[model samples]
Target: MERTESNGPVTVPALPSLEPIRLVDRHGRRTAEPVVPSPDHDTLMALLRGMVIGRRFDRQASALARQGGLAVYPSSYGQEACQVAGALALAEQDWLFPTYRDSVALLTRGVDPIEVLTLLRGDWHSGYDPRPHRCAPQCTPLASNASHAVGLTYAARRKGEETAALVLMGDGATSEGDAHEAYNFAAVWNAPVVFLVQNNGWAISVPVEKQTRAPTLAHKAVGYGMPGYHVDGNDAAAVYAVVSRALAEARSGGGPVLIEARTYRLDPHTNSDAPQRYRRDAEVAYWRDRDPVSRLEALLRAEGAAGDADLARFADEAERVAADVRKRLAEADDPDPEDLFAHVYASIPPSLAHQRADLRDELREG
Candidate 1:
C-alpha cells in the first residue's frame, strides 16, 4: 500500500522490508526457510531458562499482590517472547523505554527482576538507574513514552551520538494521540527510534477490532514515512531476527520502524481484572493452545536441539534462578520515606518546603 505524507508519496511494497522468518507454527509445523540458526544449544537453553524464570517471577508477583504484598501487579505471562526478543535484540548503546508490562523483557535484558518488583511494589521511583541500564522506569501512561524516546533519539543524533532507541507499547496504545504525534515527529526529524507494538488481540477489555479500523498496526507506519512489519510474536527467534535487523537499520541512519507483533495476552490485564467477565473461555482456550513457550519447545524437541537429560538440567537451572530470585527479593530493602523527600526537589522551592515541613510536623505529632 502507498501513502502520501507531507514530503511525497511513500510506497509499501508487497513484501515486508525484513522478511518474515518462522521456525514453528501454532500447530507445531516446521517452516522451509534456511533456519536462520537457532541460538546455539547453550544460548537457546539460556533463553528457554530465562523464559521459565520470567514466568515464575510473574507468578510470584501475582501471588504477592494477592497476599497484600504489593499494591498492583501487571502480568507479562503470554507476551514473554515479544518482550524478551526485543530487549535482547538491542545493542548495549541503544536505549529502552518500556511500559509497565515489560518487566519480563527488562529482566531478560539483565535488569534485575527483584529491582523491577521493588518498583511494582511501590517501593521506588524507578527499578534501576537509567544511566547504567539505558532503560527508563515503566511509563504508566499509554503511548506517552514514545515522545520521550523520540526526544532522546533527537538529542542523541543532534550530539552526533550513534545510538538508537526502542520503545514498546500495546495495540490499544496506538490509538492515543501521543503515539501518532511521536511517530510523525520521529519521521520528520529522522530520529533513530523503533516502535515495537505488542498487539495482544485486546487493549484491556476492548478488542483489537475496536482499537482501530486499520487492517494491521504495522501499516500505520506508512503515514509516518517508515517501514512496518507484522510478525508472529510467539516465534521468539523470528521476533529477534526482525527486531535485530530493524535496530541495525535504524542505527545505520535509517529512520524509525514500527513493528506490530501478532500475539495474545494469555492472562488478565492485571491482578484486579477478571478475564471471564468480558472475554470468552473458548477464545482464551484457543490462544492457550498457541502458547509461545510450548510452540518453541515443540520446535526444539522436533529438531533434536536437546535431549531429555538436557531438558531436565535446563529445568533445574531455571528453578534455581527462580529460587535465588525469591531469596534476593526477600532480602530486598524497603524504600526509605526520606528518599522520597530528598528526591522531590534537588533544591526545594520555599512553598514546597513549607508543605514538606508541615507534613513532617504532622507525622511527628501523630
Candidate 2:
C-alpha cells in the first residue's frame, strides 16, 4: 500500500492481470483455439440468425420510442452478440436476471417481444410471468437485480434443485452496493449463478477509464473469490463458449463465475440520452463497422455454413419480427388507473385509497 499525498484515501494495485478471451476477430476469423469442440454448423447459423434478429429488434425498439409508442427504451445495438450468446447459454430450467438494456437477451430466451416491452411502454409492472419463464422482471435500478438473482439461486439450492441463475448487468452496475453484496454472497455460498457483465465501454455517458483504475472489470471478481473471465463481447462464439462453461460448472456444484465482456454501445444509453453529448461520431462509426450481425454473416458465408438464401431468409425473418413488435405494441391495451395502487400493500392505506378514488373519478370525468 502507498500513502496519499494529502488527506485523500490511498489506493493499492492488488488485482491480478487480465487478458480478454476471443475466439473470433472482426473479420469473423478464428482468433484463438477452442478448448471444447468447435460449435457445429447449425449452432453457428443459429447464433448468426439470433444476432440479426436482435439487431433489428434494437433498431425497431428505438424507432418505436421515438414515435411515442414506448415511454423509453435501452437499445442493445452493437452488443447483440453478448446478449444473444448469453441467453442461448442457459438451459431451459435456468433463470435469467436481466437489466433494462437486455431485452435482446430476454427475447432470445423465448420471451414474447411484446411482453418484454410492456414495462418499457409504461403499461404494466411486468409483462411476463416469472414462474413460467424462469426469468425475473427486467430491472432498471442499476445492480438491484444482482441481489435478487443471488437470492433466487440460493433458494433453488436450498430446495436441492440442480439449477443456475444467469444474471446480465452493465458495467455501471458494478459500482453499486447490491452488485458487490450479490457477488460476495454467491461466491461464499457456492450458489449456482453466472454473472455476465457487458462492459460496453460506457456506463451511460461515463467511459470505462472514468469508471475504474483497475486493468479491467473482470478483476472485480478476484476480490470476491470467484473466477473472472474476460471475453470479447463482440465475438458471439466466444461469449457463448465462456458463459456455457460457467453455467455448466455452477450447476455441477462449482461456485459462481463473473464474466466481463468487452464491447461498445453503438447507440445512446437510452432513447432519452444523446451519444453526441459524450461520445464521438468517429467512435460510433468505428463500432458500427464492427457490428456483430455483419461479422457473423461474413463468417457464415466464408465457412459455407450459410448461403445467400440463408442470409436473405434471416434478414426477412428479422423484418417480420420487427413488424410484429410494432403491431403488438400499438395494439396493447391502455393501463387502468387502479393499477397504480396495486401490489403495494396487502390492504390499501387511507391515503392510497383516497388517491385511487380521485384517479378513478378523473378517469370517469375524462
Residues 199-306, candidate 1: write the lDDT tens digits: 998889999988787778887887677888888888777777778888888888888889888888877898999989889999888878878777767767777875
lDDT of 2 by residue, 177-276 (tens): 8998999999878899899999988898888888788788889887787788888788888888889999999999887889999898887888999889
| Cα-based lDDT at residue 230, candidate 2 | 86
lDDT of 1: 0.80
Q: What TM-score does candidate 2 reach?
A: 0.92
Q: What is the lDDT of residue 314 in candidate 2?
A: 88
Best by lDDT: 2
Alpha-carbon lDDT, every model: 0.80, 0.87
- Residue 282 in model 1: shift from native, Å? 0.7
List runs of model 2 lying over 4 Å from the truth. 1-17, 32-37, 343-347
Collision count for each candidate, in order? 0, 0
TM-score of each: 0.88, 0.92
Pairs clashing within candidate 1 = none
